[model samples]
Target: MKSLPRLILDIAEQLPEGEVLRSGRFLHLGSRSAVQRALARLVVEQKLFRVDRGFYVAAVDGRFGRRSPAPTRVVRSLANALGEMIVEHGAHSANKLGLSTQIPVRCIFLSTGRSRELHIGKKVVSIRHAPKWLMALGETGAGDAVRALESLGPLWAADAVPKLHERLPEGEWSALVRARGTYPSWIWNAIQAHMGG
Candidate 1:
């Protein structure tokens, strides 16, 4: 029983960096008491972070991600737990950028997944459902929430032209389009420049 803490820590270490430990999977190990005790000691030693009762995650600053689940994997896990598609946007973007801005106080994401607002961890996330033709304008990976934002290329004006009216009602879209929506350099400069960035 006492060795449970070390055992749990070892298991967590084996997970991809940034992954957190929680009840569901670990509870399958041994007696509930032993698992609980092991977790408690690990938390005390900073081997694990207890976000709340029965909820723990490995530190994100390091190389592991609880289980090294791909970025998509992580998002899927979060969505599964929330029982919805959780787009990593707004406040989630702030976290990813290491920005000092306040988290959106909501978890809003634009998607073809669904449309509505979601409440997760005291945050309300909004999901805007888009049509497949429109969604095809961009793709997502890694930090999907951010990727979605970046994918709005000005060259995709054909696709984006339809959305510009709604996404950038003001001149910001023109300017942002010119700038090319935070894309990698050398892809295409004119689209962004012509767009007005």
Candidate 2:
């Protein structure tokens, strides 16, 4: 965040949703390449958008249009940007990962870290902390991997659990479980049992 220029800061602080950085030339001093470079770098760094041409926004700001991220990419990035208090727990990983059969206009999740509201790429993500006791039977992990588990759905244990277990440490399972909340009891139960508690 220290590398950010004051102008980039200014533009981001001003524009409406869906407006790109290049569109906000409040200070007409730099070359197109320079501005593009700044904007492009933010995008690549997940601070902005190399996601497309002539388009940019803060990665944590809600997204719109037809752009489709690799599932958990947006959520994970949001988690890192949001600080450590929020642990991706306000909603079920499956829904967040786009693996569930249903889609809430708002992106809801479960979090043992805190309770709050977030709008990610046009989808609203809500987080509410749960009791540490409830999490005893859940699993948590890196955002991309977590979304992968969600993408796998109820059949995920068969298709994804082994791979996920391989990627995560033995302790990560507890954080994820704590984040599961009260959705899809059957699926949650199966995952809890498969994980051995």
Candidate 3:
């Protein structure tokens, strides 16, 4: 019979690139401690990249030799594996919407999952817990507008409405209108004033 480490490696090789591997995935092959030791050994051998506590991903061998997957791709795969919603932070959304001139200094994201940090190579990505209303629109342009408005606050957000109305697609504008009830009174009032309601 193949050893636990060999069996774990065989399974890891079959996973799609950037797919997250957890200790539980290998538990069927051996005891928890044994599986953990096998995983650690694989990481040490450079066969796997440890993303965070209990999370590992196989390294891709490319023309440049070997390298880890892109941070965004890894995060997306992780979100899918954990069944969580992860979206770019409000600061990024605000900048993207031309509602703010300030650029975000860090790679921050808002997530429905618990807040945590993930280290991928030299970069550290932050995932912060956000309120459900803020995430209700998902990753659409309407969602981006919502997050941008929140980041800009009522005063500046009000000023941004005309520009948004001109540039935003009709469908996205309607989405914003539909979600108006979930926003604060001040924000809704600002949107209403600009929208002639």
Candidate 1, overall lDDT?
A: 0.48
Candidate 2, residue 179: the lDDT equals 53
Say which prediction, candidate 2 or candidate 3, comes out ahead on TM-score: 3
* Candidate 2 accuracy as TM-score: 0.33
RMSD (Å) per prediction: 11.1, 11.4, 2.3
**Among all candidates shown, the one with the greatest TM-score:** 3
lDDT digits (tens) for residues 1-197 of candidate 1: 53667677777777664343566667767788878887778666666665434555554343552222233333444445445544555345434443323555544555656675433222333566754433333333223322333443434434433343354435544444444444455223533443465
Error of 1 at 138 (Å): 11
- What range of 10 consecutive residues in model 1 has the weakest lDDT sum? 137-146
Query: lDDT ranking from best to worst?
Result: 3, 2, 1
lDDT tens string, model 3, 114-164?
999987665788999999989999999989988888888877878988777
Per-candidate TM vs. native?
Answer: 0.40, 0.33, 0.85
lDDT of candidate 1 at residue 54, scale 0 to 100: 56
| Candidate 1, residue 81: how far the Cα is off, in Å | 5.1
CA lDDT, every prediction? 0.48, 0.49, 0.85
lDDT for each residue of candidate 2 in 117-190, tens digit (9 for 90 to 100): 54434454566665554343444454434544544556654545555555566667555555566445644665
TM-score of model 3 vs. true structure? 0.85
